[model samples]
Each structure stands twice: as structure tokens, then as C-alpha cells.
Target: MASHLLLMRHAKSSWDDSGLSDHERPLNKRGRRASGLVARTLVARGYAPDVIWSSDAARTLETAKRLIRIIPGAQTVHHNPALYHASANTMLTIMQRESEPGGRLMIMAHNPGMAELYNLITGHYHRFPTGACAVFKRIGKAPWHDPQSWRVVDMVLPRDLEAE
Candidate 1:
């Protein structure tokens, strides 16, 4: 059996109010446009997740909510407070807790955690710019935690699909 995980970075956020805590900042216009494009691309490619886990922060939540609404087969998007600014290790722990073993799982989060998690999986640098998504597909029945069990499937960036 094979499984896949989509690790994504929250879309671009507004920094107009420096007073707002990192968690309170919201996505800007470009962010919304870019994330929307990414969402449609996921649905079109049939790589939408069965379940989505997103950080509780405003930016991440907005991104996840928008994406989930359009993900072809998606039905639920959960906000996990633990995922807010969660580190790569915390993300790994979350993956280990899943009840299912072989379905697409999407994590909406921030970087350097998103980039860090990608590095942990591939042992290479892959820029996770805002609204970026990378998928890791399992080659065998091995569990999600086993790094050797997976390989890169596909990667898409907002800039890649956005209309200039």
C-alpha cells in the first residue's frame, strides 16, 4: 500500500500592523489569490487530502479553510492548536498519531517548520515559499515515520500557477 503527505506553507501574510502577534496576522490579497490557485490545482490533480490539519493561527487557518472548501474529495479540516508554529518534530509526532496509514494527509503550517519538515523527509533543501506545497509518497507499506519509506511525489508553488 502507498500513502502520501502534503506539507504546505501558509500563504503570504499581512505585516501592516507590526503590533499584531505572529499568530494574529492574516493573509493579504496576494495570499488569497495564490492560495486559491493552489487549491484548485490540488483538486484538478486529484491530490487533495482526505483530512487536513492546520495550525490554529489566523493565516494558516484561512489558507486551510479556503483549500479545504475546494479540495475535490475533502470533507474535514481540523485546527490543531499544537500545529501553530509546530516544529518539524511536532509535525512528525502528529503524523505518528494518525489512525489511518495510507491516505493523503495535508498539514497547513508555517516555515521554517514547513521547510524543516521537508528537509527532514528528503535530506535536501526545497524552498517552501508562501503558498508552496510538496508531496511525499510512500513506496511501500512502511509507516509514515520511516523516512526511508517515502520519496518526493510532486511540488507546486503559488508562483508556478499564479497568473502574472
Candidate 2:
């Protein structure tokens, strides 16, 4: 059976505090609302992750927490500091080394990496706006390190759900 993989970019962050480091920036008002929308959308689409591997950054952590609140079945959440601004290859490497086998998994982190990783895996370029998720079905018996093994299945974007 194929396993599910979800890649999510952190929700929009607040730029109000110039003194705060990038990692310390919190989710803004729009981010908070968008996170909830994304969470509900995940549940509605039956794509709620079994486990989440997320950046330790404030925005990503808050996003993961929102998901946990709405997704009753969401089980574990791991905060990885290395994922804060990791590259696409780094993200895949970490997942391959850390993720458990045969369950829905999610990665929540910053962009450039998120968008790059999506394009690498799906063979299609996508600009991952804040609070966007790319859902994939990993092909049978293939490892997470293999880009060709993943097939893009669905997407959940905050803008797309604004009317919902």
C-alpha cells in the first residue's frame, strides 16, 4: 500500500516585531485564521497526518499545534531545529532518516525549501504560499529519498479556502 506524505509551509508570520529573530516571529492574525482553515481542510479531506515533523520555529510550531487541535487522530509531533530553513535535499534526508514506515507523515517548515521539495518530488513547480499543503502518495515500496516515488495527489491552500 502507498503511504501518505504531506508538505506544509508555515503560516504567515508577523513582521511587527523587528527585534525578534526570524525563528521567534509569531503567526500573525491572518496566519492564525489560515492555520485553522488548513487544519479543518485536512480533516475534511481525510489527509490529517498520523505524525508531524516540524521546524522548531514559532510559526511552524503554532501551525502544528493548530493541526493537532483539529485533527483528532493526529498522534505525534517532533520539533526539529534543523528544519527551520533547511534546503529541499536536507528535508528529504531528515525524513528518510527519521520518519517511521507506513503511516501518514507531515513536514511543516519554511518556504523556498518547501516549494523546492514539492517541485523535486512532484516534477512540477509550485509556489507554496503561506499555509499551503502539498499532499502526496508515496508509490509502493519506494523509499522517501526517491523523488520519482512520490505522486502529487492533492493541495490545500489558504487562499483557496478563504471562501469556505
**13 in model 2: Cα distance from truth in Å?**
0.6
Q: After superposition, how far is residue 75 of candidate 1 from its true place, in Å?
A: 1.6
- RMSD of candidate 2 to the truth, in angstroms, is 1.4
Best prediction by TM-score: 2
Candidate 2 residue runs with Cα over 4 Å from true position: none
Superposed by TM-score, candidate 1 places the C-alpha of residue 112 at a distance from the truth, in angstroms, of 0.9
- Per-prediction TM-score, please? 0.91, 0.95
What lDDT score belongs to each candidate, Candidate 1 first?
0.84, 0.89
Model 1 / residue 72 / CA error / Å:
2.4
TM-score of structure candidate 1: 0.91
How would you encode candidate 1's per-residue C-alpha lDDT over 1-39 as one tens digit per residue?
337788889999999899999899999999999888998
List, in order, the clash count of every candidate structure: 0, 0
